[model samples]
Target: MAFPLQRGLTPQEIEFLSEMEMVTVIPRQRLEGLELLSGPTEKLLPPQRATLPLWLAILLKRQRRVNIVPPHWLHPECLQVILQFETETKEYTDTFSPPPQLPGQRRAGDDSRRQSAAPLRPKYTLDGQRYYPTPPFLPQNTALTPSEASDLEREIALPYHWLEVGNMLLDAASDDLTEPDQVRRLLKDLREVRMSKMRKRVDALDAAAVAGGGVSLTGVGAMEIGEMRGFVAGVVEGLRKIGASREQARREQLAEEGSIQGYTQDDDDMQF
Candidate 1:
């Protein structure tokens, strides 16, 4: 399938949108003015289902006002299946690069493609031996955390260095040959490693900025000016891919209104 363009929103913007993405929720109690107020989607009364922003739903859930419906993918069984597949399967160099189709199956985006639970079979080469890789974890429509949503967007749209890093992280987890009970533990470790790596990169950038008197990373130790330029060029290229335009006016508006506390009613209408 053709992926959507990656441009427009910055990472920060996407995070904000994820928090604002609406989900269908069931209210446990009646809240005043709920039905009258318009949100990202149609408003309804309790104990009825309503579409509310994730942030709001989370807040209400904490207050015992609503129960957020867990997306299908987040189900324990589903997660277990995915984790099992990723663990048992050898890490492939490429998942998106023209995956192999099973007999009686059609290419991706083909009108004849069969809708079946059978997984997409991709081939992997190991020790000069060619083998059909295990079935991949098929993604589905599911509510996701801001981080998960961001990663998904990058996975399908950005397809950058981070994607390779993610795959390698999963591979590392599988290498331990841990039992099923340890899946969550390994995943937690993977997340910590990923976060630490990101933190170091941010720290490095910050240090470079400070050393350069906030002007540029130029003449900062072993860091090359060309590398900094290339980093920026990559960002611009990604933005261009998604047909993103610079919304300087909105950014300026946000800057002027410092420390905004909440989303507006209209903002709740955004879908994940």
Candidate 2:
């Protein structure tokens, strides 16, 4: 039986797929995990039902690659699984106090004094590869042009919605499973999720604007799309590096000027 061969993945996604393509059977543990983190799919029509198992079998063509799971794998039932799970996670997290900081850790205040005094090694490791952001990912000291910075924002924002959906899906599935309901339940649940996300985003954007953060895509972060939080973290780390570098450079230049002026005055006063 023939399934529609959709367009091939983009070069970026293809590269990601290549690295992560060692597809193994969804382990029993993961399957059981999925049972909690993902809701059971609604029975598909004959053609629709056959796609996943088929895609799953064919997807194993690569042996030594890191497998990339597209965010949409939990589609059709997306609204039910992704959005509900996110909403629940946030509500649960808010009730808990934040974790305590460990001793010997430099707080932000102490760190400022030492920051420019030390060079930062902005290397991060993911799946064993040293991830230094060259263009979009920002990694550490990679300088970003204004356009490149804008591009980073675009790339990060693109994945936000998809991540939100995937996270919510995983969360919904994590709970104990009950008997499957009708398709309407899926649509209704999803609609509710979409609505909630919109409301949250609006509130966030408004707050960001009021706080002078420029255009803030607030709740759109780890709160909505739970799955891609790691990706978001990566982008954030990159931005942090960019900000730190600029600030460090500014402070260093100012300190150097102060030292130079002080020395010149002492030399003149001392006589020659």
TM-score of every candidate relative to the true structure: 0.35, 0.25
Writing each residue's lDDT as its tens digit, candidate 2 over 191-231 gives 45544554444444434534658433333422333333344
Write candidate 1's Cα lDDT for 1-272 as tens digits: 99885544444443443444445567778665443232234454776666665556666766667766544333335445444443344541111122223434454565554442355455545456655532121222224446655553222111112222222223432232234345445445433433343333443443443355333221121112222344655644564444433456667678766534244434666742
Candidate 2: C-alpha RMSD after superposition: 19.3
Which candidate number has the best lDDT?
1
Off by over 4 Å in 1: 1-14, 32-40, 91-272
Residue pairs in candidate 1 whose N, alpha carbon or C atoms collide under 3 angstroms:
5-242, 6-242, 7-242, 8-244, 40-268, 40-269
The global C-alpha lDDT for each of the candidates, from Candidate 1 onward, is 0.41, 0.35
Highest TM-score: give the candidate number: 1
**Candidate 2 lDDT for residue 188:** 52
Candidate 2, lDDT over the whole model: 0.35
Off by over 4 Å in 2: 1-224
